[model samples]
Target: MPMKLYGVSDGPPTLGVRMTLKALNIPYEYVNVNFNKGEHLTEAYAKLNPQREIPVLDDNGFYLQESNAIIQYLCDKYAPNSSLYPNDATARAIVNQRLFFNMGFYYSSIGAYALAPIFFDYQRTPMGLKKVENALKVFQIYLERLNSKYAAGDKLTVADFVLITSTMCLEAIGLDISGYPLVLEWYEMFKKEQPELWEIAKAGMIELAEYNKNPPDLSEMNHPFHPTRSVK
Candidate 1:
């Protein structure tokens, strides 16, 4: 009857969409898929999202996937006036560019290195550290450009959400983001700018990180933690 959202409890992509809904004051039902249990691979969930990813949104009969798209849809349909998406060309272009960079550049390096190493327990071997280093270098460069003027005009948009999500993973993976003063400033600003939503997001991230740190039961999920994991 009402909007239904399929998501995982611990994934950042879904968390970003959920937070956007909260920030925009949109109400929806959240359905949690246990990724570790491969619930997403079941035929029932596949009917909702063929890709078997979390953060799928079903509104009446309309279906949507991808975290950014879900957030944009909520903003466009429920709160067109929200600062999440800019109306102007330049500002919109900036947001798009940053989003592009986020996906194209940072996604691979960061996901494989920082996120996999820590969250997946792939082990931060030399190769893993190198991948993380490359990603962090890109993050540093990216943050340097995010002065008071971020991806869009002077407001917080989806771009900031995407960056911050990945940054949370980066921080947990043993990267010292403090070297980037502007990034630290921006992180503080994102938290201060939306204290309530940020607090909720921070709590979610902390829970995810803590869960990842624990020794997972190999039988809990078919996917066992990669051997050679380093204890931090």
Candidate 2:
């Protein structure tokens, strides 16, 4: 049986997984879990991921949650020798560091500062925006320090797949990416080099931006990420 990916097309994390899958030329069945339609909230979906997150990968009987974990597993299991994930300990460590940055800082900053206000119907505080700005500044420094074309290093790894989507989210949400010249250059080059994945990134970015333009009545729905609805 082919692997199954459960996610929506317009999610940043989901797009990252999709990019990784395509880059590795791995064939899998996409099982859309449209959160907007409350599909992900169903008990059936919960069986696959108790966290109720998208981008769950089901490879035969084994199920994996978290986009980064899924992508790494794909590369490791399907294409162990692929440079996109590297076999070298030091090189792979760098990629792992970048991926951690994305999960713990980069994407989290935007999710808190930008997406939170839009999704939860709250005003974005200056402090929140400052956190996001700091993340971008650090990202720029990483590029300049490493002097590499990609996030982790010179090679395009799983880190790039994850970072690029978050970067595009920053751009789509009207964040000024112009200040980070290196990030802008790298982002453009990544898109140019992988046009197919770029389409998915572009679509997800546009979808996010457009949805936030006139946010729907989320009051009727309870999201796990919502401040009041969050699980303790």
Candidate 3:
């Protein structure tokens, strides 16, 4: 049986999983879980992932959540020898480091600063934006040190997929990416090299941009990230 992925199309983590699947040419069934409709909060979905996160991977009877873990699992199981996820201990270590960076710093910064205010109906704070810039600067330093064709090294890896999705989120929010020259260059390279992935991820980005232009009134709706709908 083909794998099943429960996800929201426009979600960055979900898109990262999708991009990884596409790049690895892995066959899977996509089950869209609409956040707008609160499908993810349903009892059935919560049984699958108590956290109510998207991009839950159902591989036969086995189920998994968390996008980065899902990506690494796929690569380890399906594409062990693929350069996108190297088998070498040292190289793989570097890739793992980058992936953790994405989860801890890069994606977190984007979510807190860029996406949170727009989607959850909060005011954007200067402190939040500064944190994001600092995260970008760290990413820029990574690129400078490796000085390779991709995030982990010359060869593309799951790290690229993870980081690029977060970067795309930053772009969707109208951040000036030019300040991070290495990131900008890397972004352009990824666009040209993986045009199809870009195309797949772009629809959600366009939707996000449009949504930001005229945000919905979430006063009546419960904030999914918070219990009391209080801004963080």
Candidate 4:
């Protein structure tokens, strides 16, 4: 049986997994969960993913959550010989480090500061912006340290697939990434190199930007994850 992936149509994490699947030539079915309609909150989805997050992968009834983990699993299990996930211990370690950095730093900060304000109507705080900037600075340092065509090293790995999705989101929000020349260069290179996969991410950004044009409704307003909601 073919693998099944559940995710939002325009979700960044979903895009990352989709791109990874395409790059590895792994065939899978995609189920788009409409978060705007609260489809993810339904009992059926909760059973598939108790955490109620997008981009859940099911391989013959073996379910998995978390975008990074899914990407690594696809590469490791389906395409072990693919350089997109190097078998070399040192190279793979770098890829793993970069993936963790994206989850803990780059992606998290951007979602909190940049996306929360636009999508959830959360007020942007100075501290939040500072955190985003600091994350970018660290990304710049990582680029300098790796000094390769991709995030982890010369070849494109799952790290590039994941980080690029976050950076694409950053760009969609009109955050100027010019200060980080390496990132900008990397983005441009991938834009040309991986046109089809890049289009998958770009299409999602376009949808998100369109959705942000109008004011959100009561359902969106009342969501606990809404920007204005105070964390307990």
The worst-scoring run of ten residues by lDDT in candidate 2 lies at 223-232
Query: Candidate 2, residues 1-232: lDDT per residue as tens digits?
Result: 8999998877778999999889888889999886665677778989999888787999997999999899889988999999999999999998999988999999999877766665565667898889888898999998999999888888889898888888887877788888889988999998899798888899888887876676644544566655422211
TM-score between model 2 and native = 0.92
Give per-residue CA lDDT, model 1, range 29-137, as digits (tens).
Answer: 8888887666776789889888877879999889998877787788778878767777677777777776666666665566676556543556557876676566666
Backbone clashes, each candidate: 0, 0, 0, 0
lDDT of 3 at 160: 87
The 10-residue segment of model 3 with minimum total lDDT is: 223-232
Show model 4 residue runs off by greater than 4 Å: 215-232
Ranking by lDDT: 3, 2, 4, 1
Instruction: Write the candidate numbers in order of decreasing TM-score.
Output: 3, 2, 4, 1
* C-alpha lDDT of candidate 2 relative to the true structure: 0.84
| TM-score of structure candidate 3 | 0.93
Could you report the Cα RMSD, in angstroms, for every candidate shown? 3.2, 3.2, 2.5, 3.0
TM-scores across all candidates? 0.84, 0.92, 0.93, 0.92
After superposition, which runs of candidate 2 have C-alpha atoms over 4 Å from their true positions? Answer: 217-220, 224-232
lDDT of 1: 0.69
